[model samples]
Target: MNIDNRIKFRHLLCFLEIARQGSLARAAEALAISQPAVSKTLKELEEILATRLFERSKQGVTPTSAGLAFLRYAGPSVQALRAGVHSLRSGEHEAGVARLGVLSTVESSLLPDVVRRLHDQHAALVVSVVTGPSAYLLGQLRVGALDLVVGRMTDSPQIEGLTFEHLYSESMILVVRPGHALLQVDLRDRSRLGDYPVVLPLAGTTIRRYADSLFVQCGIALPQQRLETLSVALSRRYVQSSDAVWIAPQDAVRQDLARGELVELDIGLREPGGSVGICSNPTTPPSLATQWCCEALRTAAADYRAALYP
Candidate 1:
């Protein structure tokens, strides 16, 4: 279809917003425009595609079959274009900028310190931090959507053309509200852990997988409870008031532990240690900003390791 070039990026963006939000009114509100403006833009899109993209029903707009198929390709294209433009705009004269993808786990653990150090060292460089699941983030790095990712190497992730450098090691622990029975050294036994209701991250997440492996390795079944979430705040709240033991990275709950808000299990459970690291595509040369960030992350990991373990 030789669609006119006048039907441009904005039109596709508007259509995506409507598709994502499931209503023209919501999409218009998100775009900070009038509802009629959204309606007019969708009309332009329908004309370009030569078909109805949305089924207008009482339930609001739902993408038609053709629209669904088109978006599967278009969405990624737009994201890639945006990433490319951001890269170009952020490039430097001698040492270009790099986008760093960080899984939330690592971001919560190490990024704050690393970013500060990076800024202090490379005053003129730009580093954009992106977040997502490890699998998704690695795919983005492979396709130049990102230059590097700070992620946990808790499991051997299966991805091609990527290199992992071990930045530091961390151990998992059972965290709960201060003065919880589990923290009582006398009650902090293996059998006690098996008896308590535990709040755990979803099984598929790296931390949960590691905890499961630890339980299996010890030949013990974890006490049944809720497979909750990865939110530190929510878990912290649960631990503060309930008899829920949450398995989490030591770094994630360190401050709470120090403040007497939460306590780590002294159960002497077999430690399940994992490496936190930096990942990048081996095929591409990393920009200076990326290299700097990697070094800064390593430094931060070292400092954290010393504070937590030493």
Candidate 2:
């Protein structure tokens, strides 16, 4: 099939946004256009390609097989075009840009410090950070949406195509607000933990597995009154204001522990914890900006490890 020049850039833009937002209205709002206009543009693009792109229903829209295939190419092409435009506008091609995916655990201190150092060294470089769960970040890294991901190394089959560089190790810690009633309870009496509300990562996360294992090792059942989340903000707020005990990564609450806002409970399990590292698709060569960002992260991780000893 010959290409149709009748399909404009706006058609691709509209199609990609619909795929991303999963609804015409949301995509219209993002593009600052009317819903009917978006619909028309999508119809035009579909006519040009002679294939349906999305399946519409009450739950919004989902890409069909054809849409998904197109998306794999469209997303990266759009991003590259935007990056080129940005470089031209800013006249900073040498500095370039690094798209990074970060996990919630590293947001405490490591990511911020690494970003600061990257900026200090490369003043014109643009660093974009996306923070989310490890699995989600890894998917984005593989799809070219992100240059690299910094977080716990996942052991799932999804990791087969990626390469991981060890940055540091972090373990789950049971934390509570200062002077919580659990502090007075005997450490060996694991049943006491059930009496209080518990905040834990949602099931299937790397940290949640460690947390659940800790309870099993103590021969205690998980608490019935439970709140599952991966958001550090929600977990911290709930744990501080209430008697809820939060099981989280030590690095996530490192500042809270240092400032006396939260205390770590001694569960007596010497679990080695999970490996925190940089994951990247092995097939894709790193850009200059990405290379710099990786180096900066390694330096920051080394500093963090050194501080653990000294």
Candidate 3:
């Protein structure tokens, strides 16, 4: 069909706004144009398509059959354009920017290796890392502000349009400062480990959930007189300064453990661990920078697994 290319883009924008807002006044309000302007654009769009795209009535405008069909193609194109803008604005001419959110545990335990490996592979890649509780990062990811989130999947909120790929499972363990009394017993034995004061991660965190589950399975209720905090450093310090055992990821305190600064408490229960993953909105076509970051993270995960367990 012979069609003017200029009107197609304009018509698409105007029609999309009307379709989105469902009312001429609202669409005009949203577009910062007049109601007449909106009506004119819709008319032009209908003229180009040679069909009525909306059914006007007292109830407001609704998409016609033709409009419904066209939206399937148009919606994704618009979204892709937005994604492209994010990629370009972040300097697409350069390799790419990987905006990632890593969970605190992974940030401490697994991220260094992943980041180092990622950088080694993509020297030109600009890595922008944001750290936070899992829920906040997921929110950013949902709104298209972040490229990827590396965090515990258990505590993850429902983020529409996102895909999650499981990276690895990590055992939650009770850790304390060096020469803690709990380490003297079998960590798998719940009764012995429950005797000491506890330093716990916040109750609802993924790590804490696993830690709590293990305690429950061992038929031990954690001590009521316990200290709770979100900061891994603070939790570690609490354990170090006093006769307290803190439940956390072994990797989060790996350096302290290796340096004889902390010891894994013998909590006599076999506790299941939690899973970590990379999350992104799968509906949007990922930018080259995002792909680079994903690859880097995967490589980091691989190298970390080899170093930690191999």
Candidate 4:
């Protein structure tokens, strides 16, 4: 079938916002219009498509089967058009934008390197980064909210429709302050870890599973005094000030280890890491800035792998 010339950009905008916000009133607020206008615009869109795009209720709205099918194309269409408009309006100076979703997995080291390399190569590229969990980041990526997500989210169910490229594997290590008592003990003797306070990733995060498993591998239980958090900076600071043991992704504390500020303890695991990489929605065509970002990511990954392994 041919396109419906009757469907204007306003219809697409309204539909996308309603789906994103899940309520006509919220969509109206987002678009700076009245709720009635949002309803009228949505009704017009449903009429143009000759199908019910959303199932409405007091609880809010959810995309119908037809709406979901339409969204696959509509989301990317709007994102691409926006990027094109940005590039055109900025003349030849701007390289458009690359919106990124980041997890704690790369926030400390790898992400910084990629951004530096991206700006060094494409000075005028507009880059935005959002940091969060795998599930949230992947959800945003599946929509048009993010161009790509970079981290150890390969195992997340949300990674289903997106594409992931393995950069390298990063291991989890036990870390302590420079003069912590654990440093004096052998790996076998260190199994009595329950004696001290511990810092852990918050439950439900991808890395927390690894942190828990490290305890299982050592036949230890988390101490009664345990601090759980998503912030790497918080975990690092807390561990540095006290005797609390920390389960940290190697990359998160790589510089500290190198600088002798923190020490890594061997838990005797043969393999200690998970897949670290980049994930992007295959449906969307990447803009110039996103392409440059991907290229920079790949280059950074190559260097990261060599540095981590060798």
Candidate 5:
């Protein structure tokens, strides 16, 4: 089938947006069209290509195998077209752009320094960063919505089609406010954790798995009075104002630790931490800006590891 004659750019746009959003209504909103219109476009594209694109359900849509395959080409093609238009409108040479996905683990420490150095070195380059759970970020990376992701390598089905490079290992720390009652308790007593309210990452996140494993290894049950979130701001606030213990990545609360705002509890689980790293779609060649950002991230990781180990 001659796709040039049968398919329009709008078809690719609609298809890509649906794949990204995983819902017809959400894709329609994003594309500024009615849901039926987006659905119609998807049907037309599927017919043209002689393949079913998405598997729809009450919750939303997920890309079929063919849809996932098509997304690799469609997403980059659309992004390139947008970059071209932006370049033309700005009357400047096409500056490189990298869309990055980040996990919360690196949000406070590794990401900031890397972004600062990237901008300092490439003033005209555009870097867009999106932070989310590793699973979601890796999904976007697979579909070409993200150039790369900085996060822990998870043993998840979504990680199947991507490549990951180990940068460092990140351990979870149990922390409390500066003068919490737990400070006087024995560090080895895991059961004492139940005496206080707890803040933890939402279930299913990579770090949360490690956090949960720590409790299991110690033969301690998760606290009944628990707050589950990935928001560092909320966890920090709650831990400081109340006797809530926060389970978080050491990197995430580094500043607070240094400032004596939070104190680490020494439960002393010897389990090795998760591998922190970079994940990218192996099929998508990195653009100039993406390559530069990758290098910056490696440098930042190197410095961080040296500081920790040295």
Candidate 6:
């Protein structure tokens, strides 16, 4: 394939911004260039491709099929170029940076271990971590804004178009502070859990489905009084100080359980649990730092996962 020598980074940059903003004017403002310059650049790109890339309208510009096709390649190229430029700018000795998105489940245990291992090996490397729901983070991953997404997001609908590698399986655990009254009795008693305030994952999350299922499996009704949240820190803190029982991802409360700060209610789960792993865009060639982090995640998870399931 003979690539056009006239095609430049500027052309792709302009096209991406125009497609993203849906207007030449907005793209111009973003790029700090005049609208005419934006139009001219788009024209040059279209000419180079010998195809009409976008259709102009009173509302805005919409990408033609060719434009969308160009966009898929251009987006990753720009992101990789930007990341490479960033690594070079950081310093010759620096290990570089990897952007990672973490869903809530692994944020507490597995993620920290991965980071610690990575930094210990390459102190100069910066690992930027973004925390959010699976859908949002996976969307960023598919767009190449994120290098890798960690945690249990295997069940997310947004996981389409990405690859997930399972490191281990995790399940929800019902926990409460030590010496709680409920701790003395049979946890299977549906009425016993309802007496104290309950802490749960926010409704609609993958973890919440497991939490809800636990109750149904045990024939327990949803507690009338419950604190709905996504914050592991908040839920852990709240559960420790009060009689509130927290339904948490096992990893989230692992340390607490080990240190005797929290105790799990022995309600055995029939199912293995949610899959915790790494999600990445197989199309994107990983940077050195990302490669290091991925290696670290796999190495660390081997030991971590062994202890978890065994």
- Number of the top candidate by TM-score? 5
Q: For model 4, state the Cα shift of residue 18 in Å.
A: 4.3
**lDDT, candidate 4, 1-310, per-residue tens:** 9898999999999998888787899999999999999999999999999999999899999888898778777878888787766656747535557899988868888889988988787767778999888887876776588999999987687687689988888888889998888778776865678889988878887788888888888887788899998788898889989999988888899988999989887656723768888898889988777888889988988987787668
What is the C-alpha lDDT profile of model 5 across 101-165, one tens digit per residue? 98888887789899999989998888899988777788778666889988775665678767888
Clashing pairs in 2: none
Which 10 successive residues of model 5 have the least lDDT summed? 86-95
- Model 2 per-residue lDDT tens digits across residues 60-109: 99888788667666656666677668768755676678999888888777
Q: Which is the winner by TM-score between candidate 1 and candidate 4?
A: 4
- The C-alpha stretches of model 1 lying farther than 4 A from their native spots are 1-97, 217-219, 308-310
Per-residue accuracy of model 1 over 210-302 as CA lDDT, tens digit each: 777766655669886665676766777877888888887777777778888887776657455678888876656665677787788878888
Model 3 misplaced regions, further than 4 Å: 1-92, 155-161, 185-189
Give the Å error, residue 260, model 4. 1.2
User: Candidate 4 lDDT (Cα, whole model)?
Assistant: 0.84
lDDT of each: 0.73, 0.83, 0.73, 0.84, 0.84, 0.83
Error of 6 at 272 (Å): 3.0
TM-score of each: 0.66, 0.77, 0.68, 0.86, 0.92, 0.78
Residue 7's lDDT within candidate 1 is: 74
lDDT, candidate 1, residue 177?
Answer: 79
lDDT of 6 by residue, 1-310 (tens): 9989999989988988887678999999999999999999999989999999999999999878787667657777889888767656746536577899998788888888988988788868888999987877876676577899998887787786678998877778789999988878775555677677889877877888888887788776887889998888999889989999888888888888999999888755543468889998877898888889889999988998778657
Q: In model 3, what is the error at residue 224, expressed in angstroms?
A: 2.2
The RMSD (Cα, Å) of candidate 1 is: 6.8
Model 5 residue-pair collision total: 0
Model 3 residue pairs with clashes: 114-300, 187-266, 187-267, 187-268, 188-268, 188-269, 189-268, 190-268
Q: Give residue 57's error in model 5 in angstroms.
A: 1.6
